[model samples]
Target: TLYAVGDWGQGKGKTWTRAGGVKLAKNGNAYTGTTTMTKGQAITARLIKVDANGKTTWDEIGDVKATADKTKTVDLKWTNAVEDTVDITINAAADLKTGETLYAVGDWGQGKGKTWTRAGGVKLARYGNAYTGTTKVGKGNAITFRLIKVDANGKTTWDSAKDRKSKADKTKALGVSWTSGKVNEDGTIPDDSAISISGKGVADGKLSIQKGNLAELYVIGTQDATPSDAVWWSDGAAVAVSGTGTVYGVQTGTAKVNVKVGNQTATITITITIK
Candidate 1:
């Protein structure tokens, strides 16, 4: 019998499994089995030989390395996995007022309890007008956080909204621009504004795309906004847009495309007509 082990296993103390055990081949020297794991993950397996009287012998230990097939969707197992420590760096906006202490609070240790009062806010250092800080969090898990400005009098004001990162890692860098704000009156953060889009190929607030064809449009934004701040989305099946404002007509139907940045949002309806 063969058993698989490592982070992919079921749970604590239940790490070993013979679920997909295989018998030795005709040569009586090799066996085969399969277990799915995420890309870049390393796993180990052991071959156990059980005799008639239940005596067990450990034969060989094999190391298995897994890689992802980008061409196909792979299921991920989240249980019994090790947590990686991720370092996060935050840069505050230029307009942050004086006497305000910048803080970082989220799902990690800085604010594990989810309450502002219990949140051990990590204070950022002031570098001229900008506040910066480096903090650690758990990788492969989201850290929902918001920039908070605490006045000398203990008054706390949150940024326009709470920003959440899906599966945070060491490579992520966050920027906080105090462009808009609403008091955390009820301890709830406001939603960030979306980007605005406009111009040619749009009619009556709707974009027209020929079925099985592609359409291009230029999105306009404020002088301070850059192309990197634009996020685009389509509400219908098969319709998609490139980061450079090029829309692909996948199927014949209507869809809504939304572009957002910070606290501004603009949406246009897409009408896909038969070619």
Candidate 2:
């Protein structure tokens, strides 16, 4: 639409006509002509209609009340001028279809197709067994772990899903895994690393007798210079040598060895007979 200064009383003719005047016609979606419109003037315009299939018609769609006189190109200078530019914004959850007229009026910058600046950042949270991170997530964002399932043994694997590679990026993440050897409920050596030794000469043997007896006490271990400590318990008392761990003495009957460290503990037994 276009407007002129002062009250262009001569409407619909010379003083006010379509885009190209009576001889020529406007082609675009919309066009208008206006005389100097004062603050109180009823600013109105006509809408060129179109059918569902794309048709134009000389029909009145909508209009807006112009702001005070001060809000204009030259203020009081040009009372009635066709406002050519107006700001506006169009938001659509889905794509825009046909025959959709998103319009605005009043002052400049009040038209469709205006862009807006969004504020704030995105958030993420866990939903059931899965997680959903929102777009625009912060760089150093973190979230707590919450488990909702327990194993058949009534034990929950909490803290097992902790992040391992501190330098890994979650955006382009490929995969994640963990490393933990399975252990028995009683904390015994897993069958995989268990040592099985049996023999009459080294196992079922006599250690002490009437001064003329010898016990073939079996000693099975690494010949490494650094010998692990040997821990042996007689009855209920704890006994040891240079170091109490997994070592044996010259003679021995049925003896129990208890080893403990950290959060793990193990015990072994050796048997012997008198000559």
Best-fitting candidate, scored by lDDT: 1
Weakest 10 consecutive residues, lDDT, candidate 1?
Answer: 69-78
Off-target runs (Cα >4 Å) in candidate 1 are 1-83, 109-113, 162-164, 180-275
Best by TM-score, which number? 1
* lDDT per residue as tens, model 2, 168-254: 112211111112222121222234323221112222222222222222111122111111332223432222211222222325345
- lDDT of candidate 1 over 59-159, digit per residue (tens): 44343333332211111222322325655555454445677677866665443556654255567776534455667776655666667778878898776
User: Each candidate: RMSD to true structure?
Assistant: 16.3, 40.1
Clashes of each: 9, 24
Residue 55 CA displacement from its true place in model 2, Å? 99
